[model samples]
Target: MPKTLDDELHTAGAGASGRRERAASVPRVAWLIGPALVAGVAYLDPGNVASNMTAGAQYGYLLVWVVVLGNVMAWLIQYLSAKLGIVTGRSLPEVLGARITNRWGRRAYWLQAELVAMATDLAEVIGGAVALNLLFGVPLLWGGLITGTVSIALLVLQSRRGPRTFEFVIMGLLAIIAIGFTVGVFIAPPDPGGLLAGLVPRFADTNSVLLAASILGATIMPHAIYAHSALTRDRFATRRGGPGARRDSGDPTRRIAWHGFGISRPADEPAPAPGTSTEVPTGVLVRATRWDVSIAMAIAGTVNLCILLLAAVNLAGVEGTDSLEGAYAALGVALGPVVATLFAVGLLASGLASTSVGAYAGAEIMHGLLHVRVPLILRRLVTLIPALAILWLGFDPTLSLVLSQVVLSFGIPFALVPLVVLTAKVGVLGQWRNHWATTAAGVGASVFLIVLNGVLLWLVFTGA
Candidate 1:
């Protein structure tokens, strides 16, 4: 006979015991670190490079506050996303999907999200193509093809080897990105006084306001918010009546343990009574998640700042430094070939790693929001088409990257408003629902982002 849901849960719980025993030998914190790092890749994609480079090159330290502000807000937002998944065992998209009862409303929501994800892909694939051209003189069309192909391979790795392995590989790429982008700052540091002065919130012109929006868009990505919740859900959520279950049970102390990485109840602890709460040790998980998010954001934020500072100190007021290709050539002239090559390498790594993550986010978005599970390969191809088309049509790659970020900025409110609403709902998260202060902060960030995008539109339309 086919097994029932309870039978499946029992089998899963039994299977988890051995893995938990094995995990007991490892450090507890190691189990919680990977998800945020993977999600954080969104903040460092090619869009970020284009936005920050243009900001510093064109304005020279004028928009430093935007980068810093975006990062600060990202920390709070990412933490809320992770907390929602951990407490409820559902991703943001999954939650939104189940709650939006109207079919047309659900489709409408998915459409905007789909556009945002495609914009993300366009930036990443284009960045890869530009990097390949810079490094090996590959034509843009072929380079885009190669980039898309390699990203598919990475997604395949995630499918076959599991999330832990995928995390390790992405983390390795992140290291290369960090080193590649930040090495130049050491070779030629920014003016300390100018850097300090840039901290004061101000804009140089309408163009600077546009770059600031692009920077915020590149930094606080909608897909990353969607992905982080899903990442946590995948990594930590348990089967029904298994670990991390939300239902109440007889045994109050029967906390959830790591499923594959192996944290289990101590040998001395009493066995869980039948029908115990399936809740994991949420306090422990939340603490670890905070550390995970902090580390990931710190790395992403530093690399982005370094990219801007590199351009500000060296490429400021330089003609033809606004584009990635132009910036690469200018870096070679100003800081020599080694620095330029490293920057290209970092851009390449950023493209490769972030595209894989972006593709993963797109897949989750479809599955959760539409409740339709398309094959990953098929989904990857569909998204890859837009980026490739831009390259084939001979649109300016750097300009495309920056504009794509601006598009992302516009989509931010759709993701952020719903997230703030859901996570703050008492019925949704129970005791873990946002406190007044947290909810207010989320509201404030959402409002600020909305206002910033409005200013960008006004400036463009009015020519102010």
Candidate 2:
């Protein structure tokens, strides 16, 4: 049989495990960083840069709290995603596909999910292309072609180096982004009092509210929601390769660990069922995964915060500076060419890392929803055509980035509702199911997203 997403992830994860064995002196906390970091890349993609920068420039530090709230919500969603994978051993798409029995229903889901994936790829491609244009003065059309090609090359490289190495490369790029923005933040520090005040949460107007929705759309990506589950489940299975690999429930020790972590199987999913068992303690994995997600997301959150702060300090009240390129040039004038160049370089890093992730999510969505597997290069090509078309048609690159985020906001409900519904179910998740508090939070987040989308629509039509 051809390898499924789960199969490939397991193989790659096992390879990572072998490398871990060779470097036995590495600390325990180090092992859990891969999945979370990989998934967290979505939070720092070009769409986020545009949204956060726009927010800061237009509203000063007023919208910082939205970013904070969005990241906190993302932490919860991603943790649930990791738990779902670890316990059920399926990606979100796979689970969605299995539960919806109607053939047409599945196809409809696939169509919308594919559109969401494309919107995701669109942001990554254009974001990277804009970076190249800023750095090298390349034309946007040619820049997009180069971005698509290089991103696929990175994907191919990841396949060759194995999952762990691929993760390290992403982390390396993330470090560049962090350092770049951190420098920007320090060089042009916003008011400490204003920064503290920004965290109190107040929308300046409908436009600010629109930007908040865009930031939310960018922060908690639909693709990352699907990808995290596949990543965590497969990596754990690969690392714990042994007999009874699937029979994880029999280990009373593991069950206690899960309970200790505030996770439990539902009454319906009793341990030691005829065919279910676990290789290692699920609770240990849960605890480790939580730490991994917490650290990775915290880093991501900080980076996003820095973007908004930098923009507020440098770009506020600057006319005709709504786009990334505009912001880059404005920083050059305000700070110097060096700071602007660093900003471009960080944008480049964000573009490359995120586009690669977008490809992975595209593949998982295809496989899970359609039961069809396409080559990664082919999928990259499919997503590239639309981006190239956008550039070819003379659309502004930065405007394209913002508009793509709007489409993503429209798609959020489709992904979030199903996730919340499934993760809250006892039959599906057993003791690993979300508790009452989590379920409430998940529901509230879902409603928040929907309301934001509604406001976006209202703002678009009313021009308010």
Candidate 3:
């Protein structure tokens, strides 16, 4: 066999050159893609449409800033999670699982993951069923069954074909989303300044509190954290290093490595010395992560922004949709039955998209929490059963979906506080840890959200 130069180089110094190749092959604004495709479409879920519509129609563009603010915060959070995954070779769960000395810390993380997964499933099952009801005149029970079946089917297809194939299909659906939203904006053009004003924060009585809560819930989610972590781990090709191979694993050394593609030998045996040079795998992991987060978050943010704008123009100022029921009625009046049907279907999509994400997140939680490792088939059934039953019992679909968002809303502050504390610690993220500017931005964002949420809750209770 004649060894070509490429082949020899590939065999001889694959790690170094492959890493170099990775640097050179960085996606051109293709960097702007991957993560966005993951979150953006899901963000455009039918429930989000209703929230934005409810906001815009009632407040007319006044609350648009709420969505923007939530997204800006989300961008920062997702970036940090991905960056940590890259730098640490650990998802938040793994990081927390190992870092927290106490059992309670570990237990809390497990509980949250489990609750979020179940709540998310509830939202998705109901949303999909509702959409079926709108589209095919299917009953709630039948629609729930259908949604469960279809989502399971989609999961099978995704697992078999891989993420690229699955994400591509979702991206196409997102395009349809863009078309639908863009057309909606055209059909009922919003006031430009009013839309602009919506970006500003204003607090008052009325159900503006509820509107704010909805926007926050739709934009910031616990599943996204799990999804981002798992995705980062999946996207990153890791070295199967064994015990005592530490090249300063916890030192958080300020090193950055990039990779194109390289062959790796499984950790054969004990290595030579501390100063001896072997590429640190964690460095490469972190860099790729930043790329993933930056690209994905940008796309998700833009589409989310568009949804708010669309709502501002079409439904924000309308009189009818003061509540969920009002939203259905206003939708019919403004865009007629055809468009209203589309919104319901959109809601269904939101639930379905998020449900799958919920299940995936749940699986990860199980791995971290109960140390349970159920097969994916069993896992799917376990989550689906409760959700379907809820639908069958005549649980109010819209309200239940809305509650899922609320759970997400609360989960954000809890999940993020730990993330900030854990990653900022010198022991965990080391050189890749949060710097001054980043820490400030993250903490400020979390606090602001908590305060807004508090106000929302206060109003909800007092009916102020």
Candidate 4:
């Protein structure tokens, strides 16, 4: 006798359970994508574009290794941050606040998050203004003002939709960057040897080191870490599940406590029951996160890799780029005006979108560390002012933007340590605790970045 319809439903349910299991393993591959998306936006920020061009133009492909190395280092740190949130249920800000028993420790975390915002905001405004400047012969001051106002408006536009709207907008910006840069590459094909040389670590003179620092620094962001951890929790919480079934409270530390995560609980919740054994829902977890992470990582990582290749090809040994506009001028000579214009437009979008994220991160830090509930608009203003000043000071918009990358290089340490410490604490992650291998890698990477930054700084000061 063949099975009836009822039996089919039972078998279908079992199959669905396996998908959920896979999804649980990966957590909506989309979740993994959020960080990469954020990274893409950061990678295309004003400073990154300028520095990458300079590296490519000056040394051809000698500095290509910086992009790979930086991304690898950053990937290591970010992966740990993600793991920390998934296992601990607490974001970086929350954990930092919790860890520092003393006032000084608390102050350091908050202050650094604020610094990250300030520096990030500065880069964004400058990037945006430079775009406007390149697109239309606009004055830097006016451009900066407009840039600041418009970014705040973007946040307001998304206010009704909730916070992650900024991230969505940033994703769109990343697309623009990809299109523009890809077009630029098509225009000026890269030389194979210079491009290959760029993939290797070279210590050729002092300026190379500074440019390399900028590239590495591009990955080190305090707020991105805070934002990543928080976004995971926020996304989890919003996924139609309650705390016990889903643990979605933007705290990476709460994995087992989620209920509304589309899973059902006996009685009221999914808490530990002494005598009853609970079967994990096959439908809920698997189809959700795994695939999303796969696509997101691929998109973000590919873009980063492409950018480095793009820079190595176009700018390597071309010369005379005092500004991003200058870099554009060079690109126009090698490539074409149309491609350069597209790049500027994309750069504009990247800066503005990332600006909004910077503001949100700054506000979160203010709220978490200082317990100060500042208005979002005010926070935006606070973050943008420095960037505005930089433009007003008659500084080269492109160079200032590139130097800001160096600021990130110095700040990476502030964010990395707490992430490493919190994730490695076995009590927080339980069985999800970082393996000894992962810990060693994290420690080694952090130390290397620290040393790299130091040498870069020494070179910068010596003007070699």
TM-score of each: 0.89, 0.86, 0.80, 0.81
Which stretches of candidate 4 lie above 4 Å from their native place?
Answer: 1-36, 163-166, 238-301, 460-464
Per-model tally of clashing residue pairs: 4, 12, 24, 54
Off by over 4 Å in 1: 1-27, 241-254, 259-280
Write model 3 residue lDDT over 409-462, tens digit each, in one string: 777786788777766777766676788888888899889878878887787788
What do the candidate models score in CA lDDT, each in turn?
0.86, 0.79, 0.63, 0.64
RMSD of each: 7.5, 9.0, 6.9, 6.8
Model 3 lDDT-worst window of ten: 256-265
Model 1 scores a TM of 0.89
Q: Quote the positional error of residue 8 for candidate 1 in Å.
A: 30
Consecutive 10-residue window with the lowest summed lDDT within model 1:
18-27
lDDT of 2 by residue, 1-464 (tens): 96542333333334434531121121243554588899999899999999999988999999999899999999988998888777776788888888889999999998988998898888998988899999999998898899898889888987675566678888899898888766888887889999999999788787887788888889889889988887775555432332113434323234221111122233344444332322234655676688889988999999999999998988999987798878998999999999899999989899889999889888889988888889988889988998899988988878778777777777878888888888888777776778899999999999988987887788778988
Model 3 ranges off by over 4 Å: 1-36, 40-42, 241-295, 316-333, 336-345
Ranking by lDDT: 1, 2, 4, 3
Clashing pairs in 1: 245-278, 249-275, 249-276, 256-280
Relative to the unseen true structure, what is the Cα RMSD of model 4?
6.8
